[model samples]
Target: MSMSYIDKNYIYAVSRIRYAELRLLDGSVFDRLIEAKDVAECITILAEKGFGGEYRDPEGMLGYEKSRLWELIAELVPDMSVFDVFRLQNDYSNLKAAIKESALDLDIPGIYSQEAVADPMLIKQAVRERRYKELPLEMADIAELCHELFLRTGDGQLCDIMIDRAAMEAILRAAEASKEPVLIEYSRLTVGASDIKIAVRAMLTGKDDEFLRRALAPCPLLDTELLIRAALSGMDELCAYLMNTDFKDAVTELRKSLAAFEKYCDDLIIERLGTQKWNSFGLGPIAAYILARETEIRSVRILLTAKQNGFSAESIRERMRRTYV
Candidate 1:
């Protein structure tokens, strides 16, 4: 096969990812996990599948699996910054955790996610010590602003909203700066879906238009102005507005339930990323592989939790996301 520069660059990485994809948990694996009599049985099945070796605790096993995913990706991609769009949310999440922990003087364990490019502990230290210069420029400013907002108003929700909006904007900026079509599309879909979710929640809670406007981030795929207005009007108006946009198909899922809508959004992204399997070039395949693995891990976690709780198989299946394999 004739290979272009992009193809040649990612040839080895894609080949390795092909092998990695084979081990991804599919629907059958989830079925078994769901049917497992107890958490121990579920852990055994996961161990047999090489998910998290010897970690009996479900949370421990899941955490191990997440860390392993990032470790593998780090080994494959030399310049990890290429995937910053995926990791930026974790950074913001850590910032949120740190800011709240500092304000409340609470040592909240397991609140920080390890799937970020920046060290979570460093971010926590920077926030705790008010050392803004120690963090990245964008993050430093956001941390300071969120800290001040939380301190002044004692409104955790407002602080969270500000951080979430900033995170989405950062993801959008990273996607645009990369100039990768797949990354840009992924970012747009993520941000647009997030905006929709925020609007829906705000509408349901009877939040004012000003709150919605502040919470929703700008995205190329959806008109933010129209979205805020629709949200202010009600669910019907919001659905009607969505029908006219690129997210027309999501209307059905939105009607079903919020969980259903979330699944639909994730499935849409997975379907788009699945196309990268046939392409032999660039960062798309790598990005797809990472996302697919993350999705599979999430599905496994859900099944494990449901099984541990003795939930019905049908109920677990309903919440299961689309498998990439």
Candidate 2:
């Protein structure tokens, strides 16, 4: 929220981030995690490395790590609002959870995110009390609509897609408002990736145009109309259209599976943000650090879940994302 947000050189922040980058989970730590005999050993390894904060269980430990991440970022930055691109999704996610919770009148454990701009508990209250004004402006109307839609029709999928599309649009607005290259690129990539996933999924499932149009959020990088047509026409057409955009590479992964394509999308962002390590000024490095840490957390979650499910190391490795380090 400064007059010129990135005018001040973040020398100390960049240096500290560089130092912290060394501690990011790398291949070796991941190897130990993958090879761990059980979840207990994995927890012990993560705890020894300064994770699992105050609890040994995965959910509590991961929640602690997430809270600690935001706390650390708040201490390092002048205005945390510049990082709304990362936090806004949590708000939308909470909105989704709150809508469902209110409609069902049930409290689902571990359903909401921690440390979002809006309190998750407050969102639940607003929806339950029918006080839309209590929610953030971006979410107020959508919360009302989604809550009613779910209540009236009991169509969870429909409500979910509506909220998902809204969340992507919210991310785009926040990214542009920040006027940061890293945020903007991440936002566009998110929309582009998500829209393609919708189209590909729709195509395979033989979804109609109305459903596709409703599900696809607008993006400057991809033509929503053309993508919709391609998806409706056939998978071949969808793959051909994808080949022309920057997301052409994603087509190959889409052929392999949705999970593979998701990993590709993630690695693509990390590849771009990877260059930010050399940046010593402005918000890019700090933003990249946030992203790197989030990716680390996500990767850990994936690996540990796979281990608990008895997945082979090779299968887990294929799903693991590229680290920032």
Residue 162, candidate 2: C-alpha displacement in angstroms: 1.0
The residue pairs that clash in candidate 1, if any, are none
Candidate 2 TM-score over all chains jointly? 0.94
For candidate 2, the lDDT comes to 0.88
Kindly list the per-residue Cα lDDT of model 2 for residues 1-325, writing each as its tens digit.
Answer: 6566654677777888888888788878988988888889999999988886769899888888888888888878877888888888888888888888888888899888876888888998999999999888989888889999999999988888889899899889999998999999999998999999988888888889999888899998899999999988987898899899989988989889989999999999999999998998878999999998999999989978988898888899899899888
Q: What are the root-mean-square deviations of the candidates from the true structure over C-alphas?
A: 2.8, 2.0
Query: What is the C-alpha lDDT profile of model 1 across 147-181, one tens digit per residue?
Result: 98897888999999999999999999998988878
Off by over 4 Å in 1: 1-8
- Listed in order, each prediction's TM-score against the native is 0.95, 0.94
lDDT of each: 0.88, 0.88
